[model samples]
Target chain A: MTQHTTGAYDEELRDLVSRIAEMGGLAEGLVSEAVTGLARIDIARAQNVIFNDHRLDDMQRQVEERAISVIARRQPVARDLREIIAALRVSSDLERVGDLAKNIAKRVIAIDGQFHTKRLAFGVEHISEITLEQLKAVLDAYTSQDLDAAHAVRSRDDEIDAMYTSLFRELLTYMMEDPRNITFCTHLLFCAKNIERIGDHATNIAETIHFMITGEYLQEDRPKQDESSYIPAGYSSE
Target chain B: MTQHTTGAYDEELRDLVSRIAEMGGLAEGLVSEAVTGLARIDIARAQNVIFNDHRLDDMQRQVEERAISVIARRQPVARDLREIIAALRVSSDLERVGDLAKNIAKRVIAIDGQFHTKRLAFGVEHISEITLEQLKAVLDAYTSQDLDAAHAVRSRDDEIDAMYTSLFRELLTYMMEDPRNITFCTHLLFCAKNIERIGDHATNIAETIHFMITGEYLQEDRPKQDESSYIPAGYSSE
Candidate 1:
């Protein structure tokens, strides 16, 4: 009887971990599709990303519900409790990542006919590719519970921030070069910001994994190279 | 002994609720101060908003810790479970609101020396004011468990969306008007988007409250008037 009960409990936890992996996979796909749509200005591709977000949202809800139910039934403490809570945290981050991708898709649609600048999205796409890699690595680290891999994902977030800063400068330069580029450039700027935030969410998932494994919150401040927040576009610290 | 244990559990739940309330108050203050700083271009006020965000973050962490501890101790199900989960959700929404406010404050500092257009902050300020009110009402409804009030807050999110749409148009016009205005207007556009996101968080909290009271997720689509997502600023849809 005890073996049966333990088997059922293990199955529940395993299901939750798998669901989170599914969310992570779908979120990565949406983000990749969204950024590609922006780069190519393909409204149909962007729409697919937009529509796929609902399935991601549904999966997130299911994960949260399952996590809460496990907590209630198992009365889990310590490690079990941490795993359930981490599932909740990771799922929420994945949901936000999906929403951010949808935001980029919306911009792609918004800028569809404007077609004023095609080269502009290259920077946005490049940053997104890096963010997607971080996301995939963190999700893998989370499922495998690899501490070093999680730390690696956490350490790499600053590079994405630095890349986003440079992208911000590129978009700003494009806007200032001609008034006509302002509309499309602004959308690309937000697309880049959305990708940067996806990187942040990946870092968040990494921290959740770290805390789950170590039972200690990562204490140090995340190094941020996003000085774009401090420096206005036209200004030069040089 | 049973009574004493029950009292302790109740105390833990009470502490979680009060901590969430404290976080809500701090988030509201941060939003108001951040927007006011933008209006007046007050660097000190903006800096204060940025620093005080740490307090809000700490409060959220504390709330989550207490909520999880309660779930572990009480093994709460049904209504008690809902209340605990609601606290977790509300704290998260409030934390994101604080982050959004800090984003606005950062933009204020970024645009500080430009002084390109004092009038531009007016529209941004107006939209933020409405969002703040929505946040306040939603937090109050969440604490009081007022379903009607939550619905009211949910209903009004559309108005905030409308206000954000107009503000987006105004900022777009300012940017397209001159290259000089592009830099400052870009900052303002992000600030406005941040405020709009705060409103979305408020609506999210309201939905959480509704779920807590009714034990059912709100099923209707949130009416969004944010047509700016589909319209490029320089192009006339007509």
Candidate 2:
């Protein structure tokens, strides 16, 4: 291959990476805004998050097409091929992150001023803060191909899972306390689950980053502690 | 390209398709068993579903690696390239379907013989039946590259959404009637949701099939009718 050909190939790869970066940024912003809107009960901001998801979708389509084109043109083997596959997988994960965020935004509109509980809102905010941080760190790991950072994000997901389990218990107690609270708490529970799923997506990207660097899957089982739905022994029905 | 070269390429493509088909079959079976386990409260069947999910994950990894290897060796362009990309996307969707089924299986163990309402179980069975049908139809469409069949699957998602909304309302009513039913009904709600999300994944595959055949996205917005979360107007708090 000529020097000029190699230069053009490198340039195309850079463009693909930049597009993924842009999509990642959009996804991160959407999750943050959706959680904020939920916390503040701000309909307009939630609406904004919902409306902006189309952009992430469009960017994902673009990245996919460009990646395919590069593969066809370059016929890149080994590491280059792995990198392209990683980009494709990461883009899909980010697009899903956008959809989960949109689901949370939709819940905000659904709740619609029926009830407000400060402590419950605090629980959601705390979980969202940790999830957002994990997403940011994972995206950075992908950009830098930092294996250790990616492993760190993967290890830390149990924190989000544990938090989600506690929130689930609290919401269930809230609902059991009063029938009127049932509808409101149900929506909050879904919102919290969406956040938890977003954390899972972040962990997925972390694994993808690890694979991209090593061409091997993370050998250990994903650490998970979420057991909120489990029923305890000897709990008698009223 | 020589006839031998073309023959080898076709063989490789066939192998890839067959792997996807195998994964699809496994995912379909898992959904069926998980829902049946829930309906019958059979712990063994539910545990079987949980155990089977790892196979789908392994199949997905194999599909991805094979697809990347094919692209590197063949540099397939245009339709061939699209087909490989479609395979990757479909495998991912099937893997997620497997995860959602595992989630239902987990919920089966969680409810733990506390309460078993026949009517609620019937509702879940009904929704799972429809979603399983959709998955079957979409997989068939992908295998045959039948655009019309794919579009039909995409159009039928609204039916699942409507069913989910009714189930949500029914479950809430049960919870309100007896506080003792709260724990059972909440777990049922999550199970119903996992089925609804499986429907969404089927729709996603339908769209992917359409793209593989036509190289264009379905232009219309996805039809949605889930409004159970919406707070009703003029509802006074008790």
The sequence of per-residue lDDT tens digits that candidate 1 reaches over residues B158-177 is: 99888888877778787777
DockQ per candidate, 2 decimals: 0.59, 0.47
For A113-194, candidate 2 gives per-residue lDDT tens digits of 6665646667888999999999999999988889999999999999999999888887777777877777777778888888
lDDT of 1 at B238: 27
Each model's C-alpha lDDT? 0.84, 0.84
lDDT score, residue A121, model 2?
68
- Candidate 2: stretches off by over 4 Å: A1-5, A232-238, B1-5, B229-238
Model 1 chain A: lowest-lDDT 10 consecutive positions: A229-238
TM-score of 1: 0.95
Best-performing candidate as measured by DockQ: 1
Angstrom error at residue B227, model 2: 3.5
Quote the lDDT for A73 in model 1. 81
Q: How well is candidate 2 docked (DockQ)?
A: 0.47
